[model samples]
Target: MAAAVFLVVVVVGIVSAVVAMSHRSPVVNVLSLVVTLFCVAASYALLGAEFLAAAQILIYAGAILVLFLFVVMLLNAPEEQRPKEPRPFQRAVGLLLALLAGVGGVAVLIGIEVVAPAARVSGDARAIGRLLVGPYIFAFEFISVVLLAALVGALVLVKRKH
Candidate 1:
């Protein structure tokens, strides 16, 4: 049952990612991305990473996706922008870069051996707080700053046009 649920979440995540990438409308794409984030959070929950799941839902699905949708609506972006075909050279370069990334990821995965799951931690909130403040302190602060900048930029852009 757990395995089936995990599989379903993974499949949904993949489908949502594909939809997000392939959708022509920005609003639809953002909605698809939110769906993807939700699936990711579900996966995290299944893996017993409750704190991570909540963070994924709160930060990515709630805050970031909402901001994306708001910006798209505020700009009144067109539903169907003309797609640009990449030049041959650009396409070749992109393919090469993608291949390199794929190879690197495969190599890393092969090098790292999977470990069995440890006992699940209780007090998820406290654990997450400690984790964020310890090794991930810089990342937490960086994200906060980035979010602040995005908010300020959005306000400035909207205000100037008004």
Candidate 2:
């Protein structure tokens, strides 16, 4: 039962991610990404990492998604207009590339051999917190700085357009 649910969550996550990337409208992309993020959280819960699941929902689904929506609205980004007629040549080339990529991915997967299983690590909140503040503290701080810079850039762009 758990495996079945996990499979469903993973499928939904993949599908939603594809939808998010394929959409032209920013609002549609955001909505699809929300679905994808929620599915990811569901996947973590299914894998018994409840702490990670909760964090995924709270951080990515709640805070980051809201921030994305705010950025979309602030920028007043318009939906891209689709071409009146589809280009068959472009579609054919894209299809051929996609097929080639799929073949390469399958070949790589088949060629790879695992010597030994990786060590299982704890996913508890305390352990994660400790790791965040421990040797990875610089990485954590760097991410925060990057996010801050992005927010500042967004505000500047908004102001400049006026």
- Cα lDDT, all candidates: 0.89, 0.89
> Candidate 1, residues 1-162: lDDT per residue as tens digits?
998998898899899899999988999999999989999889888877888889899999888899899889999988786679889999999999999999999999999989997787663788889988999999999999998998899778769552
Question: Per-residue lDDT for 1-162 in model 2, tens only?
Answer: 988888898899899899898899998899899999999888787666778999999999899999899989999998888867759998899899999999999999999996785565667899888999999999999999999999899788769553
Candidate 2 has what TM-score?
0.74
For model 2, which pairs clash?
none
Report the C-alpha displacement of residue 37, candidate 2, in angstroms. Answer: 1.1
Weakest 10 consecutive residues of candidate 1 by summed lDDT: 153-162
Q: How do all models score by TM-score?
A: 0.75, 0.74
Global CA lDDT of candidate 1, please?
Answer: 0.89
